[model samples]
Target chain A: MSGADVLLLALGAVAVGAGALVVTTRHLVRAGLHLVVCLGAIAGLYLVLGAELVAWVQVLIYVGAVVILLLFAVMLTRAPIGPADDLDRAAWPAALVGAGSGLGLAALFVSAYGWRAVEVAEPGTAGLMGDRIFGSWVLPFEVVSVLLLAALIGAIVVSRPDIGAKDAKERAR
Target chain B: MIRPVVPFVVAALLFGLGVYGVLRRRNAVLVLMAVELMLNAVNIVLVTADTTVRAAVRDAGLTHTGGVFALFVVVIAAAEVGVGLAVILQLYRLRDTVVVDDLDLDAEPEGAR
Candidate 1:
């Protein structure tokens, strides 16, 4: 294995471990923190895989935007940052299902690939990504921007402070 | 040589953990967090597959397709979380709790008041 492969393996392990912690941790803030770690490691993995644009995008979107949104939601909702007695349901069933699916998928992958190696090509650079995004994928790119706009408007409408009043007025009629 | 299967396997496991969190977590926010994990896992697989294919076939057009797809997924996931958090906040406002178990699926809205 080359140095890049080893680094990729280490990052993957970090990602997997931190992802597990995101689910298993009792503290809500800590879980969010773990998610940061998990996502950061995944970004590192993306870097190792030679997708520089995706890696930076992962760091910016997942680590920066998404987690901050989560933290804001957590605080705004007044969710308990510390351990709550009822935050988790029964553990055994989840564990069993999770482990079963994980191992099953792993086995399937191993059997299908059987230690086969695929050569790593030239890395996907930002410039190439931009060209393609503007070239053929422009429609989807524009669509995503529209989606973000709609989501923003919808979220504001949905969470409006006057929603209860509107509901009450509708109910009275 | 970097085996493409390694990343694929890791992606699967991450997805499994995400499924576990979604299934077992009572907190709505936690479930959303798990959903992110699942999304990331999918991204990993896509990028890995893209790399392997590009290496083997050497097609320029097909080169960064998967990466671009993954980028779109990330963007959409952000939008999803934004809307999701808004819904969660609304639920919290209405019910004063974020626990999924605490939601009354069958309860009448009129009766709730």
Candidate 2:
């Protein structure tokens, strides 16, 4: 009914649609591109929901970094650029589960809050989010930074086989 | 005033689609992409919950927890992707294939024994 509500619905539709394409597309590279669109649309949904900081962060991280990483992986793995026939497994079970959960969850939500309107919160700006992150969330924030550092080191070690080969050989001996 | 159910439904459906993709995709990278979809759906739910529960949380002096959690999820997802890709690339190096079905979890490498 309201402008924000309308925007939310439209963006949600775009996101879901693009997400479908990201999954079902035959071309491997195109799936990555579709993921970018899907993520961008979700970012728009975040904006409409008044999460300005999260929305921008979604764009910067998901659309910008994650998708690029996926694309690079796809290329590095030498996925076929054209349509691949064996990209999908059997569909019946997947379709059944997908539709079951999707529709079932939708039904549950609708039944729980059918036509119930709630007041939107104040838009979350960067400053407010920053205060919360650096204030109460500072500990967890540092932990996450540590996690990132570990992941970085782990990635480097995993990718480069020579890093620990000597140690593994010594241990084996 | 937007209905909370709308976004909730969207997120649920997205998660379901993610489940399907994870099950259906043969490629390792595509499976990872599906996992990303599921994570995004969770983020949407978190942000929407922030709006719906803002009043109650503001009274408790803890506003924006959901949004902050969502941000943390983003950070975690980035890390997961980094490490996941490294593992996948290593698998590709070892086997020259990235198909999930081609991977045999129980089988030992030819020279390891």
Candidate 3:
């Protein structure tokens, strides 16, 4: 009914639409791009929720860096890009049932526990989030940093592309 | 009327789409995109929660504790993306195909199971 509601709705539509494209599309590269749009919409919703820090970080980490790396991998390894029906067969039934039930359960819980409440917080700044992250959430902070380190190492190991080839040549030698 | 619910509605649709993509797609990049879609859907829910709830999480001058907890979540997402992509890349190298169907890592000898 109000302006804020209208904005939230529009942004929400964007998130869902982009998300659908991320799935239904056939191309691997295009799907990654769609993911960026979907994530950017989530950041917008975060802004509307008054979580500016989370929104930007969502863009920076998920949209900016993560998607780029994914695209690069697709390009480097020559992943299959055909439309010949290359769907996953083994876990299809299980995944559909699990995800569907999970979604249903989430809807029930959210409506029951969260729908009626009025939020107290508004959009926050990087400084505000920074203070909290370093102050009280220090343990998780350390863990994530370590995680980033692990990911970086993993990226180097996996995406190197030359490692396995080099090993083959070494074995031939 | 149905305005505030728009974000939630859209996010649900997106979540469903992500599920389909994750299940149907074979490319690792597309699979990662599906995961991103799911994350975005959750982010929508997170934002909705942040807005609908009454808290001082946003206002630093009040209580900065809860906001810090939220920051932990964001940072964790970042770490997840970084690590997950790297691992996917490695899998591609070993297996040559991102499609889950081709992954016969344990395809040999029925008794091996």
Candidate 4:
């Protein structure tokens, strides 16, 4: 086993461990923090896999933006930072299903591959990624941008009430 | 050389853990967090596939398609989360609570308000 392989395994462990903590922890804030750790470790795994662009973008988008947004939502809702008695329900069923599927899938993958070595190519560079996105995948890229815009507008519409309605109610009073 | 199966299995487990959280957690925000974990798991699988395919094909253009697919998934996931959190915020405003059990899809009587 090379040093790089060892590093990859270690990072994978960190990511999986942190991910487990993200779900199991009682404190909401701590769960979010553990998510950060898991995401960071995933980014590290990406780095080890030689996808530098994906790794950095993972950090920037997942770590920098999404998580902060989550924290903001948590604070805005004023949810209990600590664990609540009723936060979890019917844990045994969920555990059985989750673990069973997880292990089942793992076993399937391991058995299928059977300790075979997969070739590791050069990490996809930004240049190559850009070419592909702009070249062959341009339409999907544009559609995603449009989707993001629609989501933004939809969020604003759903979260805010109509000013005219409020004004009319005030005038009636 | 790393065994591609390793990362793939880990991702599968992550997805499972995500499923567990989504089903067990009553808090809307925690459910969303669990969804994020699932998305991350998908990303790992996609990128790992890209690496393996790239190594086999030796064609730079064809191999990175997995990466591109993963990229789009990330973008969509971000948008989904944005809209989701907004909806959750609105729910909190209406009910003063974010527990999933408290939400009702059925219509109340006109005079209930």
**Best model number under TM-score:** 2
Task: State the displacement of the C-alpha of residue A76, model 2, in Å, after optimal TM-score superposition.
Answer: 0.2
Q: lDDT by residue for model 1 over A1-120, one digit each (tens)?
A: 778778878888999999999999889999999999999999988887878999999999899999999999989989776687778999899889988888888888789877777777
Q: On a 0 to 100 scale, what is the lDDT of residue A172 in model 4?
A: 82
Best by DockQ: 2
- lDDT (Cα, tens digit) per residue for candidate 3, span B1-113: 12335566566666677777777677666776776666666666655544544352455444534345555556666666667667765666565556666677764423310
Give the alpha carbon lDDT tens digit for every residue of B5-111 in model 4: 77888798898899899988998999999999999999998998787777677554577888889889889999999999999997877677799987775845233
Residue pairs in collision within model 1:
none
Listed per model, the TM-scores of chain A against the true chain A are 0.90, 0.95, 0.77, 0.90
Best candidate, lDDT: 2
DockQ for all models:
0.74, 0.75, 0.39, 0.71
Q: What is the lDDT of residue A46 in candidate 1?
A: 85
Worst 10 residues of 4 chain A by lDDT: A159-168
Give stretches of model 2 more than 4 Å off. B108-113
DockQ sort, best first: 2, 1, 4, 3
Candidate 4: tens digits of C-alpha lDDT, residues A24-56: 888888889999999999999888787878888
- Evaluate candidate 3 and give its CAPRI docking class based on DockQ: acceptable
**C-alpha local distance difference test of each model:** 0.88, 0.91, 0.65, 0.85
